[model samples]
Target: MRRTTTGPRDLPPLGVQQAFRLPETADVVLPEGLRVVCLRSPSAPMIELVLRIPFLCATENDGATAEVLATTLLRGALGRGEEDVDTELARAGCSLGAVRRSDRIEISGSGPSAALETLVGVLADVLTGASHAGTEVDRARRRLAERLPLLRARPSTLAAEALRVHCRGDSPALRLIPAEAAVASVTADGVRALHRAAVVPAGAQLVLVGDLDPERTVALLAARLREWRSRRPVGTVVPRAPEHWQRPVRLVDRPGSVQSLIRLVSPAPARTDPRFAALSLANVVFGGSFSSRLLSNVRERGGYAYWAGSRFDDILEAMVIAVNADTATDTTVSAVAEIRAELRSMATKPVTDDELRVAGNYLLGASALAMSSQVGLATAVSTTIGFGLPPQWLESFSDEVRSVTGRQVRELAEEMFASATFTGVVLGDARLLAGPLGEHLDMVLA
Candidate 1:
């Protein structure tokens, strides 16, 4: 097949088209109370497995223990050592990892469709018979200790950590990096206890997407995962994020830094709310994309920063809108002022028809792109399951984006962004930033 040699200008004009079709989905609840979500993508030759366990740590120490457990769970299981497990998975063309998040622990893996049974068996073994060896636990703990300091050295990471602490207020959920002392104190027994308490089948979701029969897959999963059970009762309800957004500006003093990292955070609407579409569109207009007002004003026109953008997190109880920028220390105040002004403008003025159309097209195009891959589809399904949304929501998303009007965008802006309560953080050299930042914000050293 000869490839087309058309230049960019010689190609046909770009236009929006309905390009995505929702995959066939089935939701099943096993007798052991494990929820299974299956999506069949016959065109893909690979199968993806995503398991979401509702794992919550009650304290910072517990959070440390959970992190250690997540790292060491796959090291050995069912009479196999770490290298043995790796060799088996490699032979089956599979890979596995587990990540501990604020609300849950996600274990994800993928392999050839023909090896689905093998993948499931391996997953079951790890879940039920993981050997939390003392040596492996100690190694994981040492690795974490070595990584924490390097992560803290980055200005952006420092800014995010400060903001999370400001907003969440010492909650274990916000403890992304446990203290070195806490990690050092973690033991193999503690890791085992955490695994037993948090890695249960109850309130867990197993999502499978690829070329397979949903019914057959469900039956196989039921049989394979039957032995994995927990006597401890797990709560299905997701906890609410803090509602308080009002706070004085926090300055994490990263001395000798030439650039300042600015982070602005506020609360927004949840994904299930009727206003979510409107907020999403409004965000695209504000700072969610390259053509957004924030980028246009701060980076493009003023030439104040290298990049500026905003993002929205759709959690269970609440949503979060965050704007991030890295600018020279001298221009930090100006960049911040421009961001605030654009936010205020979005809330007060009505968006133009062209802006609305473009933002809607961007959202739809991005969604279509995301669903074009097996991993992407699996992730989308997992997110929907986490939000407690129906399967049809993914199918109807494009229509919902198309239905958002300028008036709805403006209204959502007014409600969510007009009186936006901002908790801002700046990580930079104190000597360079203290004067300008202090003029506009109540600077506090962190």
Candidate 2:
């Protein structure tokens, strides 16, 4: 049998035909001050719920306490056993979990649209009536303790933590990983106290997305969550991470390691800043995507690392631009040099029209894809809400990305990627990296 090869197939035109639009959104503020941002997606059969509680810990110990509380929030609630809670959620075609961040405690859940009420009721029960059983707390503490060593062993993790500590200084956000001693010391009573103090209606934002009427859904949630109230006024704001101008390069020694993890941290504009769109486009061209300069230079062209990328994190008033790469220990210096060169180029040179167009389309495409599902819609809505953006902000994103000119990108790049902007860390075998890295950086051994 002979197979005949045809001529190359024509590819379809890239980019959306029209501007993407967000689902209809409704905002409601309950009497208890729990704000609800609802997105009605009739096409989806599932409901997605994202509840964000402003959860800044007062002390480093409180960080571990809050994490344990979040992990065990749904272990048992309203006199029900852990198994019973799981059974109820399974019956409703729902699953729920909570994560504790430096700035917020996010409780995320999803289920069939018809069982939205059941999910909300379960969440409310967990919020208001969590048992915080001694055994459960001990188990969670042990689990967290057991995970610490594994996390510490990863070079990438070490580099990221160091970068956070360097950029955030003494801010509570610097406590990304709880201390094992602190986790061990967290008692059930402590967890309960932290939960009661931090998880309050006034400090919470509930974002729901699904096939339901926004007003009716908000009313239902209001009634369901009414039982979970707080007496104390809620204003637990995380302090802004202090700015660091010193460009110190710290080396976290991992004995006999074959690869090095490089992480760079710099200040960035917040999401609400008018230059955010331009900066975002600049990042995309720099390293935000697979077709970015960092990947091309460090991985594809230079073969200095297996992967490379950069990300911008917008945490309320705080913002950070982080670049990450992993490379062979022998090529660590080369990879770092390439990364530094790329950062300098971003500041000194204007991006081409093609770069701007590709970045704009990529951003718009990503935004459209993010809003295509119930969960994604909920996440997007919650993120924008966290950024203090209005519901209509989503509708304007495509236009904003499209309107970003190359000049704007260049200006933002110059502002964001100046020589003094970056402070970084490299984690690897110091014996292999220290001499070479010290030649190019002000090295500090950790």
Best by lDDT: 2
All models: lDDT?
Answer: 0.82, 0.83
Model 2 worst lDDT run, 10 consecutive residues: 233-242
Where is model 2 more than 4 Å wrong at Cα?
A: 1-7, 15-17, 233-240, 314-317
Each prediction's TM-score against the native? 0.92, 0.93
Residue pairs of candidate 2 with colliding backbone atoms: none
Question: Which pairs clash inside model 1?
Answer: none
Candidate 1: stretches off by over 4 Å: 1-11, 233-244, 314-317, 442-445
**Candidate 2, residue 310: CA error in Å?**
1.4
Question: Which lDDT tens digits does candidate 2 get at residues 1-446?
Answer: 99777899778789563676777777988887789988889876988899998776566687888889998999998899899999999999999999887678999989999898889889989989998899999999999999889978866667766776665555655667878778889999988877777788885899988898888888888888888887673344355666555657788888999999988778887777788888899999999999999899999999999999999864335678988899899899999988989988987667899999888888888888888888888898898888788767887766788788889898888878765677777889998888889887877887
